[model samples]
Target: MPFDMIGGRTFYAYNSHFKNIMLKCFRKLSTSSSLMDKRYIPRRAVLYVPGSDERKLKKIPSLSADCIVMDCEDGVALSKKEDARSTIHQILQSQAIDFSGKDCSVRFNSVDSGLCEDDMKEILSASHLPATVHLPKVESPQQLEWFAGKMKDILKNSNLSEKLRLIIFTESASSLLDLPAICRRGVELSKDSPFKLDGIVFGSDDYCADIGATRTNEAKELSFARQYVVTVAKAFKLQAIDIVYINYKDLDGLKVQSEEGAGMGFTGKQVIHPGQVPVVQAAFSPRPEKVEWAADLVKAFEEHQRAGKGAFTFRGHMIDMPLLLQARNILQMASHS
Candidate 1:
């Protein structure tokens, strides 16, 4: 029998055939509405709080952001990495840090940073784990496979029924080039693996730095990277989180950029400041007109389906499976909002 190590402890693993059967059962149960609520939870505004900042951690329960990310990566200074890890671990283990109605995630350092191992060790050892771990600077599918293996070991060792999820941060030129492969691997692993890959986050600052591109208010330099991230994420049925708008003080500029990102198919935006959260959320939400149109399309499609028609005309456009799916998604998002 094979054995897996987690936090220095080893355990015997199930045989391949037994594991496959269990996975099929789990997938069936996962499709239930209650267990699948996470799929519809709107992540329009994912606010990043420095792990070293106790005040911000304490404020998480009261924040209105759709997702709160306790960051151990670029948000924390190099000298305070250990301190940040300790602080975040304490917060995760605390009962007062209630993330009941909101999504919670922790951003770990890059796999090659040498700091990620210690970060993972502390996180997996915690009595309470975040819903997801956001990995920065992912350049290949092998990196995701390595992390997934560790997560499986940890969850199995802890006897935790909740699956630990992952969000990949595409922060370098290499990651951009490997986007399709990375997304494919994530989707393939999610079917039978304990580690569920939920989303892809575009990190513009690091990406621009890596490519020697100038950062600007226009954001023309990042257009291609942003589109690629969103397109691949949608292709894999994963949420696409756009880069943070660094100008927290410029609410107007943030609004403009948020709207622009929404237009480009991004499902959410990273928020550096609490003030940016509401703007980002509002930007990604379906407008009144959009919601109305989606409802109409859904009704029309159902009527056509009842009449034994596969495709029908609506507003000078053909209504088919893809268009119907898009309409249903809008209504679903509106309900969550």
Candidate 2:
């Protein structure tokens, strides 16, 4: 039944309905963008560039890391720390260190350490800063909080007006014991009603040493810490990056480590050499089959919902709410990648 109306009233009603639909669609699109920008709980690959290495500094813009980290910590010698800091500053100043659509970060030594303070001063003094500043050897949220305050003051004084970010490296026994609580602090910081922590990376080698594990490339002894890191990162929805592969010359070793990390639910692994970038990228990038399967699940779930179904069967197995969430997440990772 239609109500009687003035001339051209039906056309006006149709136009109004179409506009409402368009508005709804637009809202969903905006939400999707936010989701895309939110860092993945599992960062598949992060490339580590030694800040002192002029050769590596020159190549940052073109690297394929999902997130790139310029290291001014363990990667550089004590005498070379200043050189690395100066190099990083010049690089950020003279040329654009494009992330190639990747998240960019810089690793300063422990904030409590003099070297790290100097590193921070150098970076904060720069007109341009990396997207995130990684604080190595973080043992607790308090350390993060302290570092956040320092960075805030620096950014304010510098008048950079930029949101200097924070990423903590958990490599000590104390850090391992407090991983979960610290991650919650990260979420709290990120919400930043006050201060926010951006992410946490597992400092694999150092962590292993702290735990009295043997120094080996096998990574067998690091299982507990590594798994705990991934779990905490997911629980708090912070990016969890893997440890760096130190053997720069062994591409095969890099591949092995990258694959292992990927299988262990790590979204990304750190690379010591530019040559290792492609291997890491390939390992972390969503597999084609996974993308296809996820796409199918999404399509099927949407179709079932449209048909007034509460659930659906896929490949002879019942698909439920949890599985649907997983499918959606997979699609999200694929899209983000």
Candidate 3:
């Protein structure tokens, strides 16, 4: 009741205060910064642009990353949330930033923050809707339920395909514990609504602080959480985004982490700086040799299937349904990349 009351007041203030998330720009009003619809939009570099920074906001048009996230959560100071919200809303509503061919998004504060409702309410009431919205600090499937219910209500008049894509951050112990249920709920929502649950992003810094763990050079401490997020994502066929490499200047270090995350089956790695974009994108992309191998194996698997065979051998190795699925994922990444 309190949450709804706050949002109710916020929605009125927004439009009256003069309203507006990563809004994928659609073709109807498509300018040089419009986005394309693809079932497999690569999120190899999920770049977070602070909503409060005018300089960074302007630089968005030039960035080549797969996804652009205008942050309203941890990236912005508490005092600046209102201003950040206004700025991002205007940018989306007026097409102030050029998001051409980009999967641009906006990140709201957590439901627990008491700021998410206002953030979401203002933006959802805008003339233009974001293609995606990022929700951080999720702790349960119930939180997702609350979020989805609001999304469906706020954008009831917009086109479903272009409404919004939701990617959540699992930053707490409780969230990780309930990861399966949370992601499963997301899948269930997608099945019933046009507002799709796009991906799951692992928030390492917040998770560590929540658990009182020390940050390390190797990042071995997060091994379980990282891999677990990816495993659950794959089980439901959702996009799995790896955590960001905090050291923006250390390109080499970032590359190593990006590759490690990719090897663990993460579809992408979050990046804090523009310099890290290329390395992350390259690291997540399927290697040419691996793509070829997958293509050939898939061909063999199909042929074997047609010939009434189940288990098959390809390139001197035993192959099964699991391996075949792996091949398909590689090809999917390659094609999209």
Summarize candidate 2's per-residue lDDT along 1-337 as a digit string, tens digits: 1222233121112244533443443334335443444423334566778889888777777765567778898888888988999988887776556665666678898866767678877976777667777788887878767766666667664543435556678888888889887777766766542234656789888777777888667777888888889888777756677888777788778778888888887777777666777677667765646655656666666567679987679978899755654555555454444
What stretches of model 1 exceed 4 Å from their correct place? 1-38, 159-162, 293-329
lDDT score at residue 96, model 1, on the 0-100 scale: 59
Instruction: Go through the candidates in order and give each one's C-alpha lDDT.
Output: 0.79, 0.68, 0.77
Q: In terms of TM-score, which candidate is strongest?
A: 1
State the displacement of the C-alpha of residue 68, model 2, in Å, after optimal TM-score superposition. Answer: 2.1
lDDT of 2: 0.68
lDDT of 3: 0.77
Cα RMSD of predicted structure 2: 12.5
lDDT of candidate 3 over 1-337, digit per residue (tens): 0111231121112121111100111111112121123245678889999999888999999997889999898789999999889999999899988888788789999998999889988877778767788999889888888888887777677765454678888998888999999988888987666577878999999899989998875799999999899988888777899987887888778878988998899999888888888788778876656755766676675567579987878878999645655665565555444
TM-score, structure 3 vs. true: 0.78
TM-score of every prediction relative to native = 0.80, 0.75, 0.78
* Model 3 stretches astray by more than 4 angstroms: 1-38, 293-337
The window of 10 residues in a row where model 1 has the poorest summed lDDT is: 3-12
Top lDDT prediction, candidate number = 1
* lDDT, candidate 1, 1-337, per-residue tens: 3344343222335455644443443344335454354445568889999999888889998887878889999889999899999988887787558887678889999988988888988876788888888988889999878877766666676765666677899999998999999889877877666757888999999899999999997799999999999889988878899988888888879889999999999999999888777677778877757666776776676567569887689999987655655665666555545
Q: Using lDDT, rank the candidates from best to worst.
A: 1, 3, 2
